[model samples]
Target: MGFTQADYEKFRILRVTHVAKRFDELIADESNDALLPEQLFLTAADDALAERAANRIERAVKAAGFPIPGASIAEVDYRDGRNLNPVAIGRIAATDWAMTVRNLLLISPTGGGKTYLACAIGMAACHNGHQVAYMRMDQLARRLTIARGDVIAHQKLLSDLAGVDLLIVDDFLTVAIDSEAASDLFSILADREHRAATIIASQTGPAQWAIDLPDKVAGDSIVNRIANNGRAIQIGGVDMRQVRSHEVADAL
Candidate 1:
């Protein structure tokens, strides 16, 4: 029997368009004529499943909001003096760190590729079917400050941040923050504690965070929650931005 328009419509209604398309393609292929019924059915099912999985990963990567969308772990440069360990990074990428709610702290100098590494790990999490969010510390502070003007929006924003599988905050403690922003940061970290993972990319370590935050107690709490519970990776190397520019100049 041949697949008809009715069959196509039914598959579309069921949201299995990939299956229908695969089945249609197989049916139109003369080479598939000798295949058994079970073989044909299984082939279509496999194709549909693979396509769906790919689509899901694509959606997750898009929703992650990575500044360097194309950044990937496999593409990382592990040159000397970077202080990056391939084995450690590979283990982190292969493990369920996000699912287990393990935080990560990336400390590096300006243009040291902290953002790229964070985004790469975030992409890995997304590939593992985890929801991820990326935002700079300043952006997060501004967001919280603006959201506070609307009560409902403020709560919703907090809830959303607290629920993600992984939250990557870049440029952490780069600038001093007000008491209100510090309070909001504490609240978010408190809510996410033991619930979700976080990645903090900062120029300096947690020791300096308290000085930059107006609320000492909240700052300490925030630092304790992140630093004590998470693993830290300190990157030391020449500024990658400069390296890349020099390479480009040489090429030109």
Candidate 2:
């Protein structure tokens, strides 16, 4: 029978309490969720358990001072029967990447899922409880230049970047690096060396990145550090961006 308004409040509270207790009990046994006979009998806020899982991952990554995923993010595809170095992921997760001082370079000819792969790795790093930050190099450079007018603010921004556990430089060398920015980049890399991991995604390979900086010495320095005992993941083949666009066009 439907309860009166006052009775409803009492029943609702009791029901909530019961659900809370159940959640506490079942949370420890995640696999037992399927044994729950009726969905309605379960607490309305049952998602608390799942949310906790996500939160645990988020918290762990944050404590590392890294960038985790936002509201919407997904892994890149490598097609059926294919994986994007799951074994490496296992090693990376178990290993303390924050201390590895290694870097990842994704070399693809644009739209070949370079950015997506970098993002996926970042997400995995977060899940494995590492801190991660992600940004396209061009965008970061652009923003840095724009924010230069505010010295107090700009320094803070650079400092903040230095604190993350993993820094993802997406589309690295997308644009030429100037003298000032090259110095800044070098300092950032130096500070992060042996203290964090870096994921660099770029259409151009390291050898082809001569356009990154005007000063050969400064440019070479940055390149040397990146390739210094670092891991490189070459994402070759046709541009996925063009392939997808062509398919869409053909469909139309």
Candidate 3:
């Protein structure tokens, strides 16, 4: 059977996923027109600037070595962040530590692509030559607990977090924050302020974060401080898991 238009459309969309070339190339009108629907690719390819942002998000992710494939600025949801309204769809291209001191908050349920967007931005910052790091809340907590094996080890872990240009904590708020962990997080955020940017991807939004955390009073204070420094992007839509599974099952 020949591939139908629907098939081709799906294929093309899938092909572009996480594929970042020259951000300009996605929309460039060149002799390459014969290869594709230049019209569509032109509109939706990738949106990035020529220079890299000096955010260490990717460095953090890399050092931690989470299994993320690649990152891109395009993966972010414009309408979801603390801003409430969508910035020009591709306007995130202009966001960087230098340009706006504002931070990013990605709040959503599982499989909502929050991590993808965070990693993409981190990757972009890395491409621009900024240091980056990624740590899940659980992982950070685990590292802290383990570091207790040596007094120096605990300080080193905190130092690693404090020095980065960008940081992403995925699955943040998964557990209630104990005083030890809460104090550590507060210190990290406080240390990174203005000098570095951090992205938090949490199942709980700022409102619920206080409740999810074990130290409600301290957690509330910490969240408020982070909010003071960043913007929250809440993603809402149908759950993508069942849909993707259905697609694969139907194909099989």
Candidate 4:
């Protein structure tokens, strides 16, 4: 009953009205609980702070532009047939690699869930308070093509891509990249090297990358940057999509 209006306003501004209300209720009726008013207020404040942190993480994840925004490591399948290593994933997650900007290279056959795994990693990075962005290689190339005419816009776009803590490039090597696109891609990777991390989900392996990229020089540059410091994960098994389709058929 003795709470100041100014204190209530401050709590509301911090988005901790629940804490404020709880304190008010405690002040009104301390007979219900034996704990001191200060102790109750501190506990409520801790809960409010945790809620705010979670809200911030959710907002960051939403802003990350993940193709599968809901992807999470908890949903990853480590069944017998899949070649994924749970230990490796654990090790990766335990490290500060995301903070150090180490790259992740996921190589798999078509429909092997490479994109999903990459997005899962991106989501984890988001949980760790890192910013992320997801884009398909062809789509990114197209965007670069459109931005080419305007030097300022092109640089700004490249800057934006490079600025994120993690950039997930999915469906890589889906098609042969032309010289211009290859150059732009290399520039983006170059700018990001040692400054930020990248996750590349490719159906094709690095060994075949040189053959797919038309500009051999630029292709080599980009591949070298990734290979030099990135950790590679070779995912092998039947396509999950096909398995899911069969399951649906059976259900039907």
Q: How high is each candidate's TM-score?
A: 0.94, 0.67, 0.66, 0.87
Writing each residue's lDDT as its tens digit, candidate 3 over 1-252 gives 334567556656876432233323543546555656554345444332212222243343466454464645654444433232445324543456444556788787877767776777666656555566788888888888788688898888888887776778999988755778888888777777777778898888887877776677777777876677887777765355655688799999
The clash count of every prediction, one per candidate, is 0, 3, 22, 0
After TM-score superposition, the amount by which residue 63's alpha carbon in candidate 3 deviates from its true location, in angstroms, is 2.9
Prediction RMSDs, each to the true structure:
1.6, 7.3, 12.9, 2.8
Tell me the lDDT of candidate 2: 0.67
Off by over 4 Å in 3: 1-61, 73-89, 98-100
Count backbone overlaps in model 1.
0
Which runs in model 2 stand beyond 4 Å of their true positions? 1-50, 56-75, 79-86, 89-95, 242-252
Q: Which sections of candidate 4 miss by over 4 Å?
A: 2-6, 11-32, 249-252
Q: Which residue pairs does candidate 4 place in steric collision? A: none
Q: Is candidate 2 or candidate 3 better by TM-score?
A: 2
Model 1 quality (TM-score):
0.94
- lDDT value, residue 66 of candidate 2: 27
Q: Each candidate's lDDT (Cα)?
A: 0.89, 0.67, 0.66, 0.82
What TM-score quantifies how close candidate 4 is to the native fold? Answer: 0.87
- Ordered from best to worst lDDT, the candidate numbers read 1, 4, 2, 3
Work out how many backbone clashes candidate 3 has: 22
Candidate 1 vs. truth: CA RMSD?
Answer: 1.6
Instruction: Say which candidate scores most in lDDT.
Output: 1
Better of 1 and 2 by TM-score: 1
Clashing pairs in 1: none
